[model samples]
Every structure is written in C-alpha cells, then in structure tokens.
Target: MIEHIIEIAFYLSTALTLFILMLPSQYGPTPRGSSDSAAEPKTTVQVLVLGDIGRSPRMQYHALSIARGGGQVDIIGYHESDVHPDISSHPRIQVVALPPHPFCLQTSNRVIFLLLGPVKVLFQVFSLWWILAYRTKPVKWLLVQNPPSIPTLAIASLVCFFRQTKLVIDWHNFGYTILALKLGDNHPLVKISRWYEKAFCKSATAHLCVTNVMASVLKKDFKLESPILPLHDRPANHFQPIQDDQERKEFLLSLSETAPVRGLLKEGKAEVIVSSTSWSPDEDFSLLIDALCRYSEISNTSKPRLPHILAIITGKGPQREMYVERISSLQNNGKLRNVTIRTAWLSTVNYARLLASASLGVSLHTSSSGVDLPMKVVDMFGSGLPVVGWSRFKAWPELVTDGVNGRGFGSSGELVEELIDLFGNPAKLEKLRIGARESSSYRWDDEWTPVAGKLLGLV
Candidate 1:
C-alpha cells in the first residue's frame, strides 16, 4: 500500500511538473512604465541571472540584489505559484521566465534520470538547443547553477562563442564529480554531465564558487583556474553582537510564539526545531531523524524527561514521502513518542522565523550530495541558532567548529552521538548556542558584497 501510494505521488509530481513547464510563460514584471523612447540604451554592464532561483528565498534575494545593484540585469527562471515577489522593482531589473523543462531541475535521485532514459537525454539536448537558438543573443554575462542546468551552461558557453560574453557559472554544487561518483563513468548521462562540467569550466571566463572547498575541488580535480567568489547569502540588516541577556530573552520569546513554534512551548516540555529546504535520499537526514527518535523515546521515560523534539521540514522534493514515511514509521513503532515530524511549504518569512526559534539547528548531506553549501545553514546562522550538522561534503567543517559555534560529526554514528551530547548537557548547549549566534555573520554575502561591488564596478 505504501509502495503504491509512493508511486502515485511520484508520477503525479512528475506529471504536474511537466504540465507546469509546458504552460506558456506570460512575461513577468519589468521596470514599471519605463517606455522604450524614455529608456536609455542599456550600458555594457548587462547581466543575465539564470537558473532555479525560485527554490529558496536567498536565491531570489541574491538575484534581485544583483539586478537592483545598478547593473542591467535580466533574470530568467521558474516562478511557479502566486507567491512571486516584486523582484524587478529596481530600474535595472528585468525578469524573464524560462519556460519549463525537466533539465532545468536539480534532481534528488540520479537513478530516476535513468527512468526517463533516452527521452531525458533528447529533452535536455532539445532544451539546450532551444535556449541557445532563442535567448542566446541578448545575454552578455551568464550566471547559472550546476547539475541539471549544466547543459544550460554548455549552451550559454556556445552563446559566449557568438557574442564576446563572460560566462559566470556559479558552483553551488559540484555536479560532475558528484554525478560521476553516483552514476559511475559507464552511464551515458554521467559522461555527458562530466563533459558539460569540463566544457563549462574551460569555457567560462569567470567561475563563482560558493565555498573554499568547491573552489579547491574545481582547481584540483578539473584543473580549471576558476577564481571563485564565495556566493554567501546573508540578511541585509546586520544586528550588533547579541550581548545583553534581556535582549536575548526578549528575542527568544518573540520567536517562540510563531505558528509552527507554538507546539514546542508546552508547560514543561522542552523543544528544539530542525528544519530544511531539501530532504531526500541524497541527504543524510535519516541519521538525524533516527537519532531524534531514539533520543525522544529514551528521554520521555527519564527522571527529568527530555522535552519533545520536533523536526519541521519544508520543501517539495521527490523523496519527501519517503522521509515522511520514515519518520511516521518511527512514530508508529513508539521510538518517536516525544517527536513530531511535519513537512509543508513555507514562505520565506515563516521559514526564517522558524529557524530563529530553534534552540539548536540541524543540517545534513550525504557524501554523494550535490549541494556544496546548504543555503539553510546561512539562514541558521543568520537566525542566530547553533547548528549541529553532519560533515558529509567538504564545506561543513569549515563552516562549523567541533566544540565552538556548532558540532560536526564525521558519520551517521558520530552524528547520533553528537545529538545525544547536545541534548544531554543544557549548559554546554547554551555555550554552543552563544557561539552559534556569534558565528551568524560569517556568511558569503557579508564578505562578498564589496567584491560584488567591484565586479559591478560600483567602486
């Protein structure tokens, strides 16, 4: 019954996604009422920001920031629902929708790509050709993400060939190396993806890597001199170091009353929140969920029974049902007696508020996970929550310290042990909590704004 339900959900999701893509894209917002006669000729600093920017809030923020930061920026991507923000509010911002195609998505399972097989390959090729033939002429500077969109970058490279444009492929996830490891070299898709990565690296004039590890990997593995600009997303307003006790208490109290947070503040029950934008097979969430279930069971029966731990995950993904089922199964088996798992779509504001209420934040990715730096970590620190993350990819260790800001465990077993420790000693958790708050300001946007200014020649 579970398997049948999952199959139905999967195909429904795929069909819906395909339907959405096939729909004709009515043009989105542009600079209000600026007539062609009144409009000045676009200066040479024109940039086209492309990819799945709608998936997360930061992506939209970053795209809009670049657009509004005085460059003639044109954004092309998905805007699924009615919750679209006024991204092109600035005089320079222009948004164009990339009519739907499967290759534009970052998939959770590589094996699923095999299910589409020849149709997938042909579709990608056709998408690439269509994008190249149609939108290739106008864009002078191309910014894109990896994996499914690597082919788009390949097409962008071809666009660069025609126009003397600078191709800026943002290394958000290490696509080629990750896919190669997951699907093996023998797979036709993997080979094409690796070739696309190699070609893009070789062809792109500038590469924007989101982390030092990604930059290092590109240089070492691919032998490309892609000078990386760490693409960090941070809050626009920088709060002064959270020093005063009253201020901290007030802030915590404020976040405690949010819709999703109300359940955590029962009379005597202690509560902690774990959140994510992406939860699927590729991510190491099972380890954390398992640990939480085990901890909840043992603690619920203790002398000073531990509080309920709620894992509130929000994001639409292929393996969401699997995650839901796993957590539900744990609950049914009585291991998650004091634990609750809820998965729903959340707006950016609600999501941020939820993160702020977390006593400790948790994030994970598997060794084969493609995303280089989970964007949620940026929100975690930005919200002043201590993070407890698994060291799956190369970047988590650099972002977190073992005993200081947060804890980084090497494997699933180690992650379980670390969660136990975090839950065991409240005093230690408080200290780490302080460290987490202190470390919130170290994200890429804070460090890269000046560089971004220089890139746009604002200076």
Candidate 2:
C-alpha cells in the first residue's frame, strides 16, 4: 500500500511539471533581427489592442494614439452599433470585429459565469490565437485590456511567447475583484480567478494602469516587478462644447418625442442634468432617482420653484431594463414629480453632443475596483460640463474637488442637498462651469503620445 501511494505521488508531480512546461513562460527567445538587423531600415512598430472594441473607449484611444504617432495598429475587437466612426475611418488603424461570445456565459448570474467560464475562455483563446498567429501582420507588441484578464492575458502570453512579441496589459480593474462583487470574496471561482490574475499579471512585459492608485495596488498586492505606467483616459477633441446654439437647438428638437425635454426646450428654462452610466450593478441608479425625487419634493414647498429638469441617463448594459422598469413604476405612482428621466443608448457623436449641451453632469459610479477612475466623469469634464459624482474611492479626490470642476457626495441625501443648492443658485453653477472648462485642456493626444512613444520605443 505504501509503495502504491508513493507511485501515485510521483505521477502527480510529473503531471504538474508537464503542465508548467506547457504554459507560456516569462522568458522566451530573443526578438527577430536583434543580432544582425542593426543596419536594416527601421520599420514602424505594429501594435494590436485586442479586446471588446464596442465597449472599451480606452482601447479605441490606445489604437488611435499609436496610429496618429505613425505606428500601424490593428484593433481586434467586437462590433457594436455605437462604435465611433473615427475608429473605422482612421487611415492607419484597422478594425477587426470578432464574433460575439456566448450569451448565456455573459449573463450576470455568478454561478453560470463560474461554471461555464473556462469553456467560454477556451473558445475565445482558440479564436484569438488563430487571428493573432495567421491572420495578422508580425506584431511587435500586443496591448491587452484586463477585467476579463484570464483568457486575454493567457492567450496573449502564448502568442507573445512563440512570436517573440511583447505583451503590455492595460490594467483597468482586477477580474477577481469584479467577480468578488458578484460572487463574494470566498467563492471558489473568485479564488481561482485571483490566482490566475497574479500569474498572468506577472508574465506580462509591462503594465499600463488607469490611475496611480491601480498601479500601487498591483505592486502591493501582486508583487509585480514589470514596469508600470499610469495612462489615464483623456478627452478627445470631438468632445468639446458646441459653439453654435442653432446646432444645439436642432439636436434638442430631434428628441421632441420626450415631452418634458421638448417643453423645456420651448421654455428655454430647462436645467439639463446629464448622467452617463454603464447601467451595471456597480452604479447605484436608485441613489440618483432618490436624489431627484427628494429635490422635487422640496421644490414643491419652496419659493422660487426649480426650473424644469430633464435628466438624461445614457449607456447600455444588462441591468438597464431593471432600472427602466423601476423608474417607470415610480413615475406611474407619481412618486417622482417634475423631472423627466430619459434613458438613451446614444452613438458616439450624439453622446458628445448631449454632454456638450447639458447644464450639469452627475456620475453615480462607485468603482467595483476602488482604484480605477470613472472614464464617464472624464468625458463629462471634456465637454465642459460640471459634475456631481459619488465619492467612494481614493481616486475620486484626484478627479473632483467639492466646489471646483465638480462636487463629490458620499450619500444620496448629501447629493440631493447639493443638487438643490446648485439648482437654487445659478452663480455657483456658473463657477463650476468655468472650472470645468479650465480643467478640460487635458486631451488624449497630449497625454498618450509621449507614453505610447516610450512604450513602443519610438521616442
């Protein structure tokens, strides 16, 4: 019996060794032409930002940045109706849309995701590998976006290993932390995801994080040694404020089907409060609804009645229908008064236009990972719209000051008070508008050019 146990242990050890050997190692063969190509003409670096292109604005930004810098970029992403025209029309960037992943696997149910996640990832890895290996140019570097980090990094690492290319992981949030939000911290799948995260993060050639806080978390939690660069998202030039009132009026008229907005436009007294959300579980839309309801209740008894409010909530996500039903019920019950809440899935140009025309912006995003800053707030600021945002994470203070470009609130009640005060006082709103405009000079091109150049060895 002892001899049989010893034999079993030996087989297990050997199997583990073989599995380790099969994985893409951190070390690999030297890149092509390292020894003999010193005299060869310089070729433009070919970069592929592989991820969901339809939803990821940062990926679009990265591809555009490289292309604008005279590098060739092939963006392998999934198709969505709202994908920006700028990406498809770019001379130096090529957009390849991958087929949609399985619908059942993308469901919000944590158990379903956990049970079938590996199978889904295996399919993704196979498709991505085929594209990377045979269908594309000899890529010098591949920048992958994380959160769905397991398969993205795992497959990218394998391709990089064989092709002798560098893998740069742009870390937005940890996939495990996001899983923990839905599945709890102690779930077995979450534990396994955490392990995969650490292993894959360590294997990457370099890491680009959205904020300094994210970079710090990676260092402290994962003990990553690869160079980490903080690459925050900045506004594109198209996000600027509308210069012509006529154009703004025309756009407003186009949405006349929404009665409150049309009435406000006719009266010229509409206090448009725009909020862009992913409609995900992380965003507490109830808080925004509660605040609006509270403000309406207070205004009913107060002198100098509030102006008509047209609250525009934008973005598409799985939880959207749930919120829409909730809001519809409230409106039907007359609990929410005097405010017209419109939910829209706007195209890129329309989204920018809406932000540009809005009087104020609100962000209800409480980060699933406490490190990454909200890109929606950045986009709002870009359009010169002052924001009132939730202050739950460390990165909030970096983006907003209480009375500066935006205000940050900790609770629904506090947000209501702030909004009431702002609506009652026009001068304070003007000050915030000025502050937002002043802070809007930080553009994507200026922020990403130097970093992309350095990372790709162009500068």
Candidate 3:
C-alpha cells in the first residue's frame, strides 16, 4: 500500500512539474493575491488545511498573526462555513478554496472511510499539488495542520523539498492516534498509519505543537531533529467577558428565538452554561448526557438543589442527530427537569458573543492522544467563563488547573457533584469566573508573536 501511494504521488508530481515547466506563468495557473501589486508584504506564507477553513480556527489565527507581522498569507482549504470577517476581509490574507472532497464528506463510518480514503486523498493530492506548484504566488514558507496528515504531510513535504519553501507542521494531535480510536491501536492499519506519520513528519523544517507533552512525544518518539516549539492555543481578541450588565442582556436578547435562550432570558435566571462540540468521536457527549441525567435526579430530591439551568451546546457534527434524539426521549419521559439542553451552530461572531455571555462552559473532549488540549476550553477561558471537563487525560491538568479557572471530573456523578458545589455557592462560581477573566487577559496576539511569529521570521 505504501509503495503504491508513493508511486502515485511520484507520477502525479512528475506530471505537474512537466506541465508547469512547459507552460508560461500567464498560460499556466493564473496569478492571485497580487491585487494590491504596488506595496505587498515582502514575505508570503501558505497555510494549508485539508478540512473546512471555518472549523479550523487555529490556522485562521495563524494567518491573522502572519498578516499582522506584515506577511501575505494564502489560506488553502474547503469553503464549507462562514469564516470570521477578520480573515475574509483582511487586506493581506487571501483564501484559496479547494474543490470539495470526492467522498467521505457526510459519513463518519470507519469502513466507508477505509474504502474511500485513498480515492479522496488522490483528489486532494492533485488539487493541492496544482495549487502549491503554480496557482498562487510563490511563498517563502508553508504551514500545515496534522491529524488529517495522510496525504497533506507528504504533499507539503514534497513541495517544500523541491521548491525550497520552508515547511512548518503544526501538530494539534496525532493522526494515527485518531485512527486508533476507530480501529484498535494494535490494528495493522493503525501501525501503518503511525509509520506514515513518523516518516513524513521528518520532512518538516520546523514543528509547532499544542502542548509540551506533545513536543516531548514528537522528539522522543518521532526522533525529530528539527526545532519543536509548543505554542499553546489562546483565545482571539473577539472572545472576552461581557462586563457590562446591559451588554450581557443585549447579547442574550440578540440570540435567535430558541427554548434555551428564552429560558435564560427569564426575569430572574439562575445561571447559563454553554458547551460546544464538533460531535466528533473525540468527545464523549454521553458523559455529559449522563451527568445531566444525574443532575436531574438530584434536582428532584437532593438537598441544596440547583437552580433552573439553561445548557446550550453549539457546533455541528455527525453524531448530533443521535444525541438530539436521546435528549428528546429524556424530555418526553419526564426525566429532564430544571435543565434545558439545546444545540445550534452559530456564526463566528455569534459564537464569540455567546461564549462571552455564558456563566460557565463545559468540555467533554477525551483526547485520543491524551496529550493534546481542547481549544474550546481555551476559548471558554478567554471568554472569562469557568469550565468543567473530563479529567482522565494528561493534558487536562495543564489547562483546567483544578480550583483555579476550572474543575475536572472523572465521572457523571463527580460532574454533578462539581455542578452542585459550584452552582449552589455563588461565591465559588464568582471566584472561578474571576480566575477565568484573569486567564482571558493573556490574549492570542501577545502569545503568538513570541513563538510562531519568531519561527516564521515575522516577529
């Protein structure tokens, strides 16, 4: 399989090279990102993502930071959702949307992914190679996200190797670790996937990861000789606490007419909790559901009972419909009370606003690699909202810091217990909120410059 993949990539790259050489710049792939030709940034950077541009906020932030450093950025990815205006309207950044995936767009079935993965990679490899080779203006450096690294890593490495473009791979999580979640870690396919990651990762000129543990793993496990820097995810400028009472009320009223929103806007609301998920395999929403169920049971008879809670979940994914059905079942059978769970996908602006106004945030991500941290938790901290999340993973402590900005729980009962303790006591909740606000003071712009910007020679 590896041999065949290499053969295909080799031939396709050879064809692309010959075609590009035969055609002149005007006749070949058209010129782009040169609209303001007079005074363009001296350095051009390419940010690559093999998935939706809107969903991949970190890469978008990377582009924004590069632009602030006076570098032209060309973001290459799929145009599935509404990207933030900062990226779309930026004068120095240009988004190059790729053709949609041939298959595997809707389903999350592992069998279907296995059967059609290669074909999908073929399509992507062709399109991505064409873009990197000739479509956009020549870039001094290229940065790509891992996890969807099968074809992307190889393609970016080959392009950088030939074109002398510096390659920087930002590792959010391991691709093989995610594949291992679907297929057992010992599966032969999983073994091969790990090998693929280790092999192509060596091609990177520099590496940036989400956690220090991840950096250690890459150096010890992948035997990386390149510089590995851990750039922790921080919330952007848009996500901040709504300190003013009128601003908070106005934000709540601006939300669409939903049951959960209506419940929160009542004359005297107790509290509002927000949870965001991609509904992907990494997150165990069942844990959250079970926690809510336990809370409901305790709400009926337990002492120091909590107030009416509006738990709003925002984001879209495949498993959403199944969980929605389960929530409906609980509501119909007279099980759910004192709590309302609603799911909606909000635009970029609305999402930041919602995060800013919420009383608390929850993260249920069970990292497949156990070393990568959840960005949603970071976003919540940025919004000055406290969080409670699963605590089994090694990475959780680095972000959660029990009794500080947020708490961590190991089970549904523990989560419910945390909820009661915090919500029942306003003083404790306020303390954590204060901690989260302090956390928010450490903004992304301040964080990005010292690490990623310096690496790109932009700082």
Listed per candidate, the RMSD to the true structure in angstroms reads 10.3, 4.1, 4.1
Candidate 2 TM-score, true structure as reference? 0.88
Predicted structure with the largest lDDT when compared to the true one? 3
TM-score of each: 0.78, 0.88, 0.91
Please say which candidate is ahead in TM-score: 2 or 3. 3
Off by over 4 Å in 3: 1-38, 103-105, 257-265
Model 3 score (lDDT): 0.84
Best-first order by TM-score: 3, 2, 1
Q: Against the true structure, candidate 1 has what lDDT?
A: 0.61
Per-residue alpha-carbon lDDT of candidate 1 for residues 182-251, written as tens digits (9 for 90 to 100): 6775777777777767766788767776677777777877788756676655553332334554444344
Best by TM-score: 3
State how far residue 90 of model 2 sits from its true place (Å). 2.0
Model 1: how far residue 297 lies from native, Å: 2.7
Compare candidates 1 and 3 on TM-score and give the better one.
3
Q: What lDDT does the true structure give each of the candidates?
A: 0.61, 0.78, 0.84
Q: What lDDT score is found at residue 444 in candidate 3?
A: 82
List of clashing residue pairs for candidate 1:
232-444, 232-445, 270-307
For model 2, what is the error of residue 373's alpha carbon versus the real structure, in angstroms, after optimal superposition? 0.6
lDDT of 3 by residue, 1-459 (tens): 999999999999999888557432442222244667766575778999988999999999999999889888999999999887999899989999988865444457788877877777788888888887767665688999997988889988877766667889999999999988888999998999899999999989899999999999999999999999999999999888888867876777667634454644666455678999999888989988888888878877867657767778998887999999999999888777877788888888788888888778999898999999999999999888899988798877778778989999888888889988888888999899989999998888787899999988886
